[model samples]
Target chain A: MEGEEQRDGSRGGEAVNGSDSPASLDGIEAILNYEFRDKRLLEEAFTDASYSPENCSSFERLEYVGDSVLNFLITREQYFSNPNLSPGSLTRLRAANVDTEKLARVAITHGFHRYLRHNKADLHQKIEEFGRSIEEYPLHSNGMIKAPKVLADIVESTIGAVFADSNSIDIVWKIFKELMEPLITLKTMKKHPMTELTEMCQKRNLKLEFRDRWQETKEIEVLIEKQLVGKGSYRKKLIAQNRAAKNALDNLDAFFPQFNQPCQPM
Target chain B: MEGEEQRDGSRGGEAVNGSDSPASLDGIEAILNYEFRDKRLLEEAFTDASYSPENCSSFERLEYVGDSVLNFLITREQYFSNPNLSPGSLTRLRAANVDTEKLARVAITHGFHRYLRHNKADLHQKIEEFGRSIEEYPLHSNGMIKAPKVLADIVESTIGAVFADSNSIDIVWKIFKELMEPLITLKTMKKHPMTELTEMCQKRNLKLEFRDRWQETKEIEVLIEKQLVGKGSYRKKLIAQNRAAKNALDNLDAFFPQFNQPCQPM
Candidate 1:
């Protein structure tokens, strides 16, 4: 589906027409001033497939690498960020953070949309304006569908660029954390296993216990109300134990919804 | 590690101080060329840590990524190069080809010894001959010991450089194949399981039969000397008894050392 004109000119600009645009991307850069170190990568990150070949190389390939890098970085960050979070919870959180829509939102918040160069032929190019366009173009058949993929691609490519430019993991984390600030709220961080289990136990007026004991082999065990619920050997480590406890807690609803309910003198 | 001496000047030309005979790196470029598509990467390959940061960056990191990329590219190439090869065999071949010492030897054959540069304080710097210089310096060390970890790291970096620069799987394989040419002889290729299995069956005058027959579902089974060895089924296809024998014949292990011996009724 092709159209002659759009209400907004998000894609078309002097830049697309091979003319210099007076609007410098300096403002966004200042806010995200981590210094990507690799200028080539930064340019590539903003580059869209719609741009002519001579203008720039698309961020598609960088995005591919970036997507994996982000998964790895975020997974690692989440694991170490809150030691109390369980593996399953971390996994779910990771999924939520890395899902396309979430990342697209992050990209948007970081002023990613302003830097994009869109197509003049299409009427509905801006991602935010998606009401009548959805009805008119029907994403599956719409030419604009490629835009999201490209935008997401740019997001990942920027990450790859950041990683390449700087060897420091801390610096990279700072950039990611800043971009994902809106999503990674204190509420999200506090909703770990410890909090979840505590809340669940409180709601039912059930007594909860977490006994941490170390064995001769330096193994850590987390017992709940005299039950041998979770154990972590030296090799398995604390992370494993935390994850086990979280998993065990998640299943409490189906198995033991009423913790205070007295058993019939069995 | 720093010492200086002045030499006598001749009538026409004379050696001055700091003129350490102008390193006779005659054929070093050729060796680097074999592994890298661009001569720049080759230059980087031979660039030891000795050069000041102003001169050039060492090949240490490139070599790290190169080694992994080389393995990945070669493993993929070998998989497709010989479609009949099993995963295990391909893995062994990959391992053998990518060993550090073996790659060092490849560097030697390619005349990499002539061009090696290292910091004077580096343990490898105390050398008299080019070949000995290579052994003493172990450029792959990245200013560390020639231990397993360092060696593995260097090998990977080199592979990564080639993969990134050349971006051609075929060229990468060619470099890898050349490096492994001495170790992987035509004779050795014949000893590969698939090849040996085929030959052994032929020598014993045994016919490999793969019977694909099943009442409930279509199945394909490999038989050496009419003895079933391995089985595969396409029950979902629901096209059983449809040339199961022919499919089995193509997948026969040509290099299997003990084909159908278990099935023979002693």
Candidate 2:
């Protein structure tokens, strides 16, 4: 496995710009504000499977480990800090921070993607689009927008690399704590639009429906009282449904004038 | 929150047998081989929602935290130890160790369930059944048997309680590392019967089907070549399916005798 990993590293290092070099790895270390003891781990973390399809480094495996580490860190942080939070709320809070979009935002914020050695053609475009979309929802879109998984994978893989090299979760937390800025607190976290709408409908004893027109128009139409209350569009059906729910929620005051809805959705 | 927790502790402490008393908590500590700073946390860990539903303790929250902690421990342990494993294999390996059945088995192995302060009548019966069923598959059933969730909950809640009280994952790991004996290593772990059968069918270019007679008979029938290859019964449909697959896989040698299957379907 070590021999194969080294071979993968050398093969991936021989890319167009030699991006997996020692100096290039140092840039990643600079971004993370932490150095690696096992330089190969860092290289492996940044080496996307797209870079070398045949003998790829353990990028996915590192992402897997990093995901579990991040989950543990976030769960521990939330469990202690928010002692009154129910398990359901804690789960959501942790998910908001560790999710693909949130981590992708982190990568963009720290320019972590610039160091990612991937030949994925649309990755940069997707990252740019995600960066632009996040401006509309400062904290999280809550499934309202499509987030390129590669951006998040790089973040997790790097996190995995850091944990693997340091072999200290505290060190990983210290470095990533700030990098993951404005950690989605319970105060900032909002219920996913669909969930809120469903609860509202349940409370009012009203029938709520989302008509999936995704095949035809890549949109989800929120229907209440057999009326098209809201419409939202996205390539992904779930995101489109969330967007539709958000649109309906925004128009609820005028649409359902008699309902006593909470003034602040949060 | 601390005030409420104290109140909950006292309320739950006044149970039928005083199982949540100081002495009982000490027994738990002895089981864990670790004492707690805030004894309330230990009490909360054992207090099931069924014990006093109106204003129960934070057992679920602790379970949530413990689940994440256990996940991280197993992931880190396996990631470094099994460097050759793919992310998929690593996931299955970790899941085999930390899943409800495995955790429930832990609770029963060391008599951890005796301390769980619950008025749930069927809980003991289910635990006994799970204990007996596990004797067949000593390591893990892989969804072959029904392991009562409450049993798993106590294990996780206790783990959470220990972590929260000690404020150290290492301490929790040290205590749990031994309790979770025969930690499902890659060597001992086996794939779910359903998954194995599906892979086998896909490899052999043979279409496979599972007829869910669960509603009528509480059983799943595995049909191959329009022949009833095997059948398995369980209350849970998925477990029934797994059992059916195990039955099918067990009989494949004598039934078909031509698939060139692995000698030991480990």
Candidate 3:
């Protein structure tokens, strides 16, 4: 047993004593046994950037690969899930989902944070400088940060590890799905101002313009072909424009549709 | 030889003629033998996205793994080379070096393009739609539009494959270094506008504002601050705003340090 411990410890640099290692690879082990299929991949997956280059492969590299895999998977899944959404809508959805906060959250939920080994002091100092809690740090906290370059590598490394251990997509997806379920709430996905505005404008064939009438209080004026519809100050112009556009769209949908078509046009 | 050909054809799910089989294996084997220590990784590296769900293993998944590895290699190489650059500058440098155009160029130079296999129709359709030429497309172009994605995947897969075949980073780096050498060109990496503007503004301690002013004529007046930057008429305010901002930023570098520095009193 001691010899076995020594081999596993040295196999990938840095073996955790009893307290640090998870008791049941129940969550991670299933992935190892079924998904990774290759032990090298499993070793790579659990690897954090802390490992010395001479002793072990760092998860940093795997995290990079996992990021794209996650992106492609999410894009494919979302596209299929929401067939009616335009490309722009899908893009926003992806941005919201794949951004650091969400990805870290997903990573954490999967017990991924436990496996990660990075510079703790650096992460803590960064959070302090940002006036955020240490818990909010993506590396330490909810794993939500805009660091695609860093976080993606960690994520990919995990995937690589999972594959190494178990070597099956089905097992990997089981863990991935659990982690992602909360973020993929139907209610959260529905509220996108840009998507709503674009859909409205596209249907009506009316150009939405938030014209800036600089003379009047540095306010933004909304004009639909020389006729003023609504106006607001500069700060609120984006919202106002969207509102004005939305209102105009709503009016068009209600009024114009009555005259043009007997039933609601597809 | 015939038996070997049959096994290769069955494993790869490709129709193979006995005569053509040896020639095919020669190149694949040469790359595989030299590059990877694990043959499974080599097989997975060559596996295309087209075969993903239909087969238990797809190159798409491996591509996912490979992309991160390539990114890490490139990023690490660049960061180590230029220690003085800020994170933002490093990011831009990385982007400039890793974009599809650059990756495709690197991929071709390394002869990695020759090992790729894809459906011709899908490849042609993507090229036409995106206006990418064959020369512009990286390997696995049929699956992903971005060249870096394909390039990163191929690079990673090749590494994985080589590791599978030979388990040697020395062998992999041999090919990787050759491909990455051209991307290290400092001349190709231009400073991003935002970075320059931020740096210029910081030196001057000047707050930048984007304002839209009106002219007496039919065209709208656009200004960075008070100066008349552009006259009436272009629909895209974004273009005009950026140009005005650029002009303001250009004149700033010379005068900016004088106002903010401790050497000169405020």
Candidate 4:
């Protein structure tokens, strides 16, 4: 395992080297319109462990800092913006904004994935597949899809790199806030499909059950009133359940023809 | 439920009127030596939902914001202090500092618990019990003890209060940096007992198992080579497991009298 590179990280196109070239790094700075005091931080932000040896891998650390920074930015922003919101609501809202899907979308939006340095060979295919998949649900799939975590990591790593270099949160937020387009505000915020489906079923007094077929078939079916409302398949059980919930929510009209108003698209 | 008060949150002494008084609030400011620009934010920081009606509860919201801020502060601090540390180690170290037990200890040390305004009737007894329990472990108990969450909440809420009032993380950190005594550094940080025990047992080729009897009697036992070496009882299964690990570690001499230098003090 140590002798072989993972080669499983992806770039946007078929471009190779997956290494941080100076020109690409400069282009990244140009796009963000923020110059790093230490260029090494920016390079580290885009670097992947598979591309380098064990001792010099820094993106994970940067991503760690970035995750906290991003969370803080969103939390602080949302707290003042929504004064009357409860902590429960605030938590859900923050999660929506900074969750893997949202940040991964940010990376794709800003072409951050193009700058990532990695050895993952199949990553290109995964990134493209994710890009195509997300077009179906513009805002968020609400856990219906399992995003490539690397996409989100790069966004956080960049945020971390900027925050570390400037040592100013205001600057970091100023740069990324605009980049994270169509921010999920309270108006745009939507409940997770599982939460929506559960509440909807409970209100209608329907016999709701998530039948687990994952072990045998990697599928989960949402049963409502003894009727198979929706089914989804995934390698992970939770994801399968979430997809099943989303499928059930989307197909609510099949169960209640008169009450055909499915969950509104955010 | 709406008609009656909770009367559950506690003050340090057996004081009545779980409502916030101006003098007590003033005392809080004096304790921190940092005045709030907006006194309402300070009030909100200490205010619990039970103290007021649903419309006016703000401490939870503040706590929400403060939590992210605290996380960001610690992550940033640790990132710089330990340049060579991996993200995995950094995560653990950050968790050690910001965990419920550590922050609760901070609250107890700084007397922040006294200013908490709530309706908890049994809180006084709980706080007193917690105060006495921590005497056994000076720095941290590492999940051996389950600290009252409200104590930790107040610390984060106050940290949030200061950050919100001053709008400067610098001031919040300056005030709280000293209050959070003996910050858990890489030098003092210890692994969770469950993790430690598993690793130690694995290295020594000891067939170790955590037998769960929590559903029956809230007990967990560590069985090594089919011998009951250590057992712990707690309301929470995870805590019981952790306690059992600690117990097993403590009784290493009993297990193996030959090589008996147990886990050292922090």
Candidate 1 residue spans exceeding 4 A from truth: A1-28, A118-126, A130-149, A185-266, B1-218, B221-266
Per-residue lDDT over B10-118 for candidate 1, one digit per residue giving the tens place of the 0 to 100 score: 1112211123332333233233345334666655655666665666766664664464456545544454466445445666665556665456545444433334555
* Model 4 segments more than 4 A misplaced: A1-23, A53-55, A211-219, A233-243, A258-266, B1-23, B53-58, B211-220, B233-240, B258-266
Give the residue spans of candidate 2 off by over 4 A.
A1-23, A53-58, A215-218, A260-266, B1-23, B53-58, B212-218, B261-266
Best of the two (1, 4) by lDDT: 4
Better of 1 and 2 by DockQ: 2
- State the lDDT of candidate 2 residue by residue for B1-266, as single tens digits: 23443333322232222233222555677667677889989989988877776576848999999999899999999999998899999998888888888998888777677677777766666766776788898788888888888878889989899988888888988989988988988778888899999998877766689998888889899988777889999777778889999999998777678677654443
Per-model TM-score of chain A alone?
0.51, 0.86, 0.49, 0.84
Worst 10 residues of 1 chain A by lDDT: A137-146
lDDT of each prediction vs. the true structure?
Answer: 0.49, 0.81, 0.47, 0.80
In model 4, state the lDDT of residue B45. Answer: 84
TM-score of 3: 0.37
Report the lDDT of model 4 for residue B210.
85
lDDT of 2 by residue, A1-266 (tens): 22443333422232222233223566676666676888989888888887875576848999999999999999998998998989988988898999988998887677666667777776666777777788888788888888888879989999899999988999999999988988999788888899999998887877899998888888889999888899998877788889899999888878898677554443
DockQ top scorer:
2
**Higher-lDDT candidate among 1 and 3?**
1
Report residue A102 deviation for candidate 1 (angstroms): 1.6
Report the lDDT tens digits of candidate 1 across residue range A1-266: 02222112222231121222312344435545655545666666666666645667566545654665576566555544654564456666676567664565555445455565544344224454422223443212111222345546667777766655674445666877767655552244334455666676666655666554544545554445555554444333444445445655655655575654653332
lDDT string, candidate 3, B1-266, tens digits: 23465334323232212221113323555433352335566555655565444453445544433444455455556545764454456566666665665555454444443455443335423323333344443332221233334544555566555533543335655766655665544555544344555565555555654455424323443333354433323334443444445555555435443533453334
Off by over 4 Å in 3: A1-91, A98-187, A190-195, A217-240, A246-254, A257-266, B1-73, B76-84, B115-266
- On a 0 to 100 scale, what is the lDDT of residue A6 in model 1? 19
